[model samples]
Target: MRRTVGAEEGDKEEEEAEAQYHSKDFEWEELRAEVENDPSFCQHLLPFQPTSTSSSSSPQAQSDSDAWKRFHIRHSAGKFFKERRYLLKEFPELASCNENSKVLEVGCGNGSTVLPLLRGNENIIVYACDCSTETVERVKEIIDASNIISIKQRFHPFYCDLSINRFPTWLACNQCRDIYLQSQHKSISDVTMNNIMDSNNLYLLRESGCCNGGVDFITLIFTLSAIPLQTMPVSIKECFSVLKPGGLLLFRDYGLYDMTMLRFELEKRVGFREYMRSDGTRSYFFCLDTVRDLFVGAGFTELELEYCCIKSVNRRNGKSMRRVWVHGKFQKPL
Candidate 1:
């Protein structure tokens, strides 16, 4: 199924697209210029350079983990759920989204969008998981309390570490074993998913607590922004592992010059740069290339990266606010 743009005014949509294109243009040119002139910047962008072998494992990791705790304290997943309701209405393709059709939501917080979404559409079974146990339980409870059992009957909520685990059955069968060997030996994070069937722990006996494959679509609403830039490849690799051929992946997150980015930078709480994110979380406020590189690195093929901003003006305060968001759609090739 395909999405249709809302009637609210196509003008704003065009403007948002232009803004995104320009922002990406600016960031890429700036970074390329910097890298061409200096070598340190290039090293800084690379995940492994040995200059700071400890950088990846040190306080960076600690801060990345801690940042989630602190940020979640200020964020209300329930509220976010309510707000994202517009997504389905605005993009009607979501309304007819099937119930039995397998869908997986990474970082399924508070079960806001997914719950109501599943309620409205039947044939669309969902396998929602989050790294946070609290969030996962919240989603489970919402599903348990909902009355969409007829069509929206299946919603499996669990916690996962996003790592693939092989099964004995996979090793015993020649075909399965061959596929498994290919996946296990492939450098999934390198963006080459040629024989990816073996790379994922899908099709095995379902684990008691983990979400292991059988997904047709993945919705990464507001989750990827929280991942460190360096870890994005790993996350994408995991995402690719579970998605079926030609499966759609919908992603929406904060973009460059977003109000949140500006506010965080003005506060000077962490390092500042073109692609780097504050709070020790490796967020890259991508324009175009960075966003493209990140996904392409993960082996996602069909891609559409857009920058969207919701603008509001306070007539009384004479203040204008813009909420910048990036949405990307990619597909694992058939």
Candidate 2:
């Protein structure tokens, strides 16, 4: 029902009170003065403008998108993935998928999760997408360098924004590109041609073998938090739209008052539960109730939700930092 991945002894009440105190707003002038006085503090509290003026097309939205693309390109931290062996150990559903299974890793950064899933099962096709074209290009580079025929055959990486419901059209264009590339050598596959013809229907594209089936599993690792708060619901619903009946969505993200959030000055907070990092990328912290509500609102049945708190110690610095994370698994009904 509940599990603590790692925790330290402390009175729960005291921790809650401390968290509340840290969340209170500070005087604007004082906060600004503190930020200005400390170069490091100023660097960490980079300002971020909202991505879109309105949900519909606008110059502001286009500018915001371009800003995000540039941010991701300049802030490319090398590949990183949580232990795959540990992930399989914790979520057995991942290991149990059959040969025809399809898994989609939203916000896949440089093939981190994608590569691990490919290594886990040669038969399981893994489709990955990221909002950053630069990130997608990096993932493609990693796959090409791997020189693994099976991985190349089973992995598909594309660039698309999951926060909106434009995935079907993006997938269609990607499929067309693949068809054109293959045609240079010989006859294009019938499946590719069928996908081009029925590109408008998400279900038909998958059923016709042009794309992977309504993905068996979708992973949103630290991805959803980057989206604007208002758009999170839309994004979650879109994830639901692409999942097959009984498919699972696995989520892991920062929890409220985590060490990272605690380190930020009040001025760095842009919206409710949202904070802007030094790199101009944004993050949102979540609690169990909010996470549960978000999925249930999107028609998912909650199977597991828990707060994992861990204390990490820096031996050299003789300091301890408490890390908080929320992990959940929700499934679409059959």
Candidate 3:
């Protein structure tokens, strides 16, 4: 009887693993609600919205930023990191660098990369951003608990209100602004970069020398694939616009034959090329060529484009599953 019970437990574990290997269908409203209920959800509720930093800003920009943050807080960062490891394992060059590097991670959900990278190399000042306030709070909590740095490496969490023109009290930049305005005499250089989460999209970051003249590297892990195929071009352009000349950009995301792709194909019964999740999320799977070409079109000079597949076997029917992903590294021209 004990042996039988052990076998049953093993089977259950296998099933659970298999379930995660495939995409499960869900409704967008339900998914949103699930995020709301998550413990990390509270971090995203910004007390106010940030005033525009760019000349071409509107009320909607703030709103959009807030919405993105809220969505980010609800996501599972742990799972994101698990999927991300396959792409980062071989990039020793990035892992080793410790110079005056400033990194901007656009959708830095749960700070999957920031935490580990900071642990490995201490010199980098990471400007990690996520649309989710909950996720940001969670990251701060994790960092605080670990006691990673003596001066605490300046981790800042921002709640993108997207509604108010005034910067929220919790905003990292706002904190800096309050001090700068109050002091009325300090040089910009005297301001601590660590104080703000660095919202460049809203023009909070100064264009010249903001990234120490330019960021040494920028990582967009698992985010590009989340954008719908149609909007991908624009998104890529935006990313390109932010990157300094000669700066490096690394991306890892679902490939053409990932589990999610298979599930999308199964549900649609037609090749939709671009698929949307129940939560109003969308994604695209890319072949090596497709990904390389997309980056090239966006004016990025490709360094490496590779496809990786992680295989898992189902014991029940002797079925095998492969999680496909595309990993790429590109650089802007000097």
On a 0 to 100 scale, what is the lDDT of residue 179 in model 3? 35
User: Per-residue lDDT tens digits of candidate 3, residues 1-334?
Assistant: 0000011111112332332222222222343355457665333322323234421223233444544554555553433333223223445556666564666665666665666666656666666655566776776676677667742654544543212322233223433343323333345674345224233332444433222333456677766665445456666755565555567888877766455454553332212344444433445667777788778988789998765544456666776655555668898764
Task: Please report the TM-score between candidate 3 and the true structure.
Answer: 0.59
Across 1-334, the per-residue lDDT of candidate 1 in tens digits comes to: 1233221221112222211111222333343454446653333333333333334434454455555444444553444334243556533455675545677777776775576567666667777766656666666766676677653357777775332222122112334334433544456473355544334443442342233334667888767765655666787876776666666787767666554444443223223322334434445455556777877777787467866645534344645545455668887764
For model 1 the local lDDT of residue 215 reads: 60
Q: Which sequence of candidate numbers ranks them by TM-score, best first? A: 2, 1, 3
The C-alpha lDDT values of all candidates are: 0.53, 0.64, 0.51
TM-score to native of every candidate shown: 0.64, 0.69, 0.59
* Pick by lDDT: 2 or 3, better one: 2
Candidate 2 residue lDDT tens string, 140-226: 787767665577778888887876545664333455334333333344466566545445454455566664445789988778887
| Candidate 1 vs 2: which has more TM-score | 2
Best candidate, TM-score-wise?
2
Whole-model lDDT for model 1 versus the true structure? 0.53
* Residue 28, model 3, lDDT: 29
Candidate 1 ranges beyond 4 A from true positions:
1-59, 66-77, 89-93, 97-99, 150-152, 161-213, 266-284, 314-318
**Which candidate's lDDT is highest?**
2
lDDT of 2 at 278: 53
